[model samples]
Target: MIEYLIGIAFCLSSALTVLILLLPSQYDPATKDKPSVQILVLGDIGRSPRMQYHALSIAKHGGEVVIIGYKESDPHPDVVSNPKITIIPLRPHPAILQTSNKLLFTIYGPLKVLFQIAYLWKCLAYTAPPSRWLLVQNPPSIPTLAVASISCFLRQTRLVIDWHNFGYSILALKLGQNHPLVKLSIWYEKTFCKSTSAHLCVTDAMGLVLKNDFALQAPILPLHDRPASHFHPITNPQERNEFLNGFPETESVRSSLAAGTLRVLVSSTSWTPDEDFSILIDALVQYSELAAAQPELPEILAVITGKGPQKKMYLEKIAALEVAGQLQKVTVRTAWLTVPDYARLLASASLGVSLHTSSSGVDLPMKVVDMFGAGLPVVGWNRFEAWSELVTEGVNGLGFGSATELTERLIELFGDDKKLETLRVGAQKESTRRWDDEWDPIVGKLLGLT
Candidate 1:
């Protein structure tokens, strides 16, 4: 069945390639002054920050950007207000595709890909303005890669793929590596990705993998994720208090904070399968036990923010722990905040926790980058090889392998004020390195903006 769909996609792409060769090139007088670039994302535009950053950077360099993606959440104000940037939202997947039943998923997966291909083609080839380049995100690589490649060929646009992680590797997490679906995804990604004009990856290790493993012929540059100027430390006590007070969720912990008996620990998650919230929950449970026995230990208010599938399940687990009288000195609260508010939360918090253990092991988590941007030191999962690149062992942040290790790191940081301060100072130093500093030189040249 998957083979049938693949054959159909191939036929469509071949037909489009021949048709485009026969058609006259499109020239718009209005886009003559600005070099147009289309940023394609198969996921939500607001949630995909790296692509948004790419759009922003392109616009800054006087390139007109058309962002094509699902607009489920509101994007950053800067992106919304940019005159040179235009957003073309794609049709969302059907509600039935959101089902958890394996049978339903297996049946509808191909249908979802077909729907995505048609819509993506329409948006890329017809609706969006003709552009010099089309930059796309990977990991939804199946139909997205095929559609973008076809459309770029049809429109006479350069195809640039920004590799976050291997899409096949992510799929392998749900289906075993030996699964036929996983194999198909691997073949699809490798086949289409080879045709990209240029490649931008999240980590240098990823770039190496592309060259060594995939044998990609394109110029691959590792453009690491860095926070925008909007993400900064909230130094003013009044500003911090005001932001925290604005949220009703933080009300219960305010008095404890004022009394200097509680500390705020912030963790931002998509509540996805890749991030194991169980580790965090276990660590928090252990912390609660320790804090109950030691009166001098600080009470914790853990603020976990983001929307995803596993959120309700984890929330229920946390609730059950509370009901059973297990979590006494620790409180866990979940929230979905605006971009600005999220930055404020990170800045105001005493520490940050990252649950992301990369699916591909070569990619670094952008959440940790955001946390560092807000001058909050992170206790990230350290199993991946790429973790060391962004997080230094004793400098900016600490790392943990298991729940026990995480709990121990938490105890050490929270118990010793001086050690936490040193890490915070390191994180503040990291905050100074903004996105544009790295983006302009490499990415600008790739897009012919430099």
Candidate 2:
């Protein structure tokens, strides 16, 4: 009887030991496992404010973000700063492959996507799984995208894509709509949108376009590409004077620069005829005498910053209008800004301008958001839903149908100090409220770290 009892005890102990070994000791059922999220931001790192905002938000949220970026003229902050972020630089993919990728991205895209699949396979095998993965809209590289898809499958990870711009629409505009490239881009967008967990767009209009055209069930999140505050406002009277001194004007012009002058600032990387900056210039001219009538009119300066395709032509236009004397008063600064510096410089301006001639509705411009953040109002065309949703005419800012209307409105806004102050305060309030309520929440949700 004693021997049998000993044998039963030994067997029970062995069984309990085996069960303990099978269970994961490291796993605690009650604790929420911190998901390992690895995001690959593949794009022109500096050019798009959306990319910057997305990457930074993810990093700030405590995710491991890696950037595979291409260098343009400016160096991006996410590439250099943020301890959580790592950047992998590569040579610009050949334009031919880019073209071919667009071609294959459609019906046959998956066929060519094998290269990306193989690349992703290797990446996943090395990195191991259960990590969340993503690829933001970028150079439109089919291979990299393929890799993302394959990596997600192999690793059993969730995949998300932030499609900032409609590459197909851009191609159709730049190239003909009937162009093969346009057709292919549309096709790739469809497939990619269908495959991803979510596709983030910059505007509601764009999201509508995707859903209506592709019939994609993928969830769409509207995320405008804009920098977080880049520069501190130069409110100090002394600092403003020093900056003005750097771009000195004659006493006549200096007197033209008055304190209350509704200063209009226009800056961009490049200006094509499509931008139609002449509208702003003409408006400045119309309000010039009126603004001059006020003590602030002398301070009413129109500063056009950055080099663009229209640089020479616009310079000629400035000269012809005799705004050249005003151009000296107008600060045409070169495009040299860290993201933060650019934001600060923009905040100092009274108004943000989105003067695109193309009728294709306003994709939410980063300038608008930056303007919002800085408490500056936007003077934009009224065709865009985004403009309507954000700006209330004569409230937050004014949107117009034509150059004449835009100019007339500018005259009214700048002429009245009470109205201008009202708009400025409203703009700052609206910007802060929108950032906290709308954009930041969306960013938090997208990161899945909310």
Candidate 3:
């Protein structure tokens, strides 16, 4: 009887040990073993605000997120602090892959794509299952989905694609739009993209491309970029002063040169080949001539933010003109800021200006959205139909067709403080619409909740 009792006790102890090993010890009651999502972006997250925002959106819902993207500055405080989120940064891309030189890009593009696929396969293998999702940021869509679809099938993981613009269109800029390889890429993207569980696009025009051109099924969501929760039109007087004082370089210039009456014209550019920063440069130059002739227009200081391949070239051009004293009372300065600094700069601006026209002719420039959220009236370059939703001519803001027209608009705005004030009020009112609210329904459906 004693021996039988001993045998029963031993078996029971072994079974309990095995069960404990199988259960995950890290599950939070708030999350309740929600599946982990891995977000993949083939480019720098610093440049891809939408990807970072998407990761934050998932984390806010009490699910774990693992961001797999190229290295960038630390994300928001909330994103960095969340225990449910893990960031895994990849090394930067080789120059050959990023080159605009068509011959080198064509030679090495496929090789780079293949390498990322192999690396992703290894990462996805260890991510435990039972409702795993892979949210792939598309634009480099074809190569990504071609490999990602196979991994999703093997792992039985669901796939979600957030399409920003067609990768082929960008490649066409380098390799010629009609190149045989560009055509092949378009076909390849459409074919593999259909395999994803759901597709999210940036605009309605882009959704049409997916629906009509690619023939992707339902659950196609259009989610536009809005200002983050941290961004609002800061109304407190003391807070406004402190924010401007934070920028030592700009502060000293404002205090010494303009004696605290400095009128700031802030514009941000990615400095990409597609953008013509020269237009804003020219507009500011023209405005300087007007400022000098009148001697009544507040001394203008232009602060342009962001950096890219073409930045240095434009900086040199702007600097030479300043040195020669051709721009009169207007001065141009360049800043490469972290996300927080950029937000502060936007808050301090008297007026917002953006030189971007859509590279794809379908997507909206998110920079304008950021400006509008700060209650800064924009004088944007009129270029696309999608912008009509944001920039209403003579209502909230103004639009111009060219640098010559933009210069005229700037002259009109600064010449009348009352008119500028009225437009500023309009921009603040526009901020309340809240497009961010549209996110949950589509995301919920993708998560299989609704």
Q: Evaluated with lDDT, which candidate comes out highest?
A: 1
The digit string of per-residue lDDT tens for model 1 on 176-276 reads 78989999998899899987899999999999999998999989999999998879998787888778777777788888887888888999899888999
Root-mean-square deviation of each candidate, in angstroms?
4.7, 11.5, 9.3
Which of candidates 1 and 2 is the stronger one according to lDDT? 1
Query: What stretches of model 1 exceed 4 Å from their correct place?
Result: 1-31
> Per-prediction TM-score, please?
0.94, 0.71, 0.86
Please, what are the lDDT tens digits per residue for candidate 3 over residues 374-441?
Answer: 77888987787667766788777898879999889888887888888788888878766554465666
lDDT of each: 0.89, 0.58, 0.74
lDDT of 3: 0.74
Model 2 lDDT on a 0 to 1 scale: 0.58
- Superposition TM-score, candidate 1 onto the true structure: 0.94
* Reference-based lDDT, residue 424, model 1: 93
**Candidate 2 lDDT score at position 232:** 35
- Sort every candidate by lDDT, greatest first: 1, 3, 2
